[model samples]
Target: MSDLAYSIVTRDLSLWYGEFQALRSVSFKARNGLITALIGPSGCGKTTLLRCFNRVNERYGNVTTTGEIRLLGKNIYDEDVSLIELRKSVGMVFQRPNPLPLTVYENIVFGLHIHSPARLNASALDEAVEQALTDVGLWMDLKDKQKSKATSLSLDQQQKLCIARLLPLKPEIILMDEPCSALDVEATRQVEELMLELAGRYTIIIVTHNMAQAKRVSHECAFMLMGELIEHSRTEDLFIRPLDKRTAEYIEGRFG
Candidate 1:
């Protein structure tokens, strides 16, 4: 419905887990190469909407969806779409860093190993690792520690590695669900900086309850209430002058 070109577009999309509906006719757009933050109280379906972009919710079982979710204008539910490819194109970063037990180098190239049409040579894999880490501003910090286990890294490093891992697959969109929630203030600031740096190259849709974070990191913000989208606007507008009373109330801390 937005006039802007969107990397993700949900058209009257709805979802349910058995009898409990989680999303109700939610329609929105996330513009290409921009950061869009989804903000809402707990159970308001922000995470659900983020997962819908990559169709990850179906893995939970007993879930059903209606309406359309288009990635770059192609309906994701189309019969021709490959789930593996879809996932590769739309990567995710969770609330807490959950790096694989493998070495840092291996973790960064894990997706490449899985998605490459042909097995990449050691040099190619190494290059991929370096580039991915460099993209995330981790090359200098982790280059010497590539042999170390990824889990052994600090929380911020692990989270950055999780994001780096997706790079080898060349994802067009990155879905981050509270990616900084587990880190301290300093680490949160660093990750926020990384998100800003990565925005022009990747469309980012982040779900966060931290209002300040949403304002600081996102170009656009969407507010949700009880699974319904209440307002969506530029970050400055939404914060300075919310169009919806509900949005104003939430932003003003009247109630979540």
Candidate 2:
């Protein structure tokens, strides 16, 4: 794909935690308005790379990163970049759903409260809540239950709530790190369907160990091994004909 077509581009990205190197000269791109899956074994840099997009890894102290990561043509590490704004543009969903203890309505409007310069009135907040939940296909189910505590909902619902919360922020990209790890098969399917629906409206990059899930949900796939990106291509192409032997082996169940 052309450079202009990508939402995220990384060049020689490397990271270290204390003395341990977690990523090594990794370079890849996630296309705009498509789902890209990062697949690799445990200890590989898939999660680390995902976190780099919004500079979330910096939260863990003693972390250091080198090279460049550009989002929408702007270098994320540039001095002028505001962390708050960057996070707003690039939202993230963790492995397990983490809903605030507030009501579903409150959770949906939480980001708006933080980012909006002026306080939104009741009607506006109601519209925002409805729109975000509708975008995530949760409006009908939760519309009447908006007053319910978010933590009281099912795990799948909570996860969807987590995703719905990001929508009100108008994020250009969404990063998911093993988002379905805590859910069952049926719940996983539901979330994947939601992901398909969310695609094209928001660029999504997911880190998953389930190769089948990657093939099923992503438009493109990147295979990583021991912190290095071995191969990246269309989902079908990479699965059928990987450019590197390591990628082929990992796909074939030979090794991670």
TM-score of every candidate relative to the true structure:
0.97, 0.97
lDDT of each: 0.93, 0.94
Count clashing residue pairs per candidate.
Answer: 0, 0
Q: What lDDT is obtained when candidate 1 is compared to the true structure?
A: 0.93
Tens digits of per-residue lDDT for model 1, 1-256: 2234889989899999899999999999889899999998999999999999999998989999999988998999999999999999999999999999999998988898887778789998899899999999999999899999999999999999999999998889999999999999999999999999999889999999999999999999999998899899999999999999999999998887
Q: Tens digit of lDDT per residue, candidate 2, span 144-167?
A: 999999999999999999999999
RMSD to native for every prediction? Answer: 2.1, 1.7
Q: Candidate 2, clashing residue pairs?
A: none
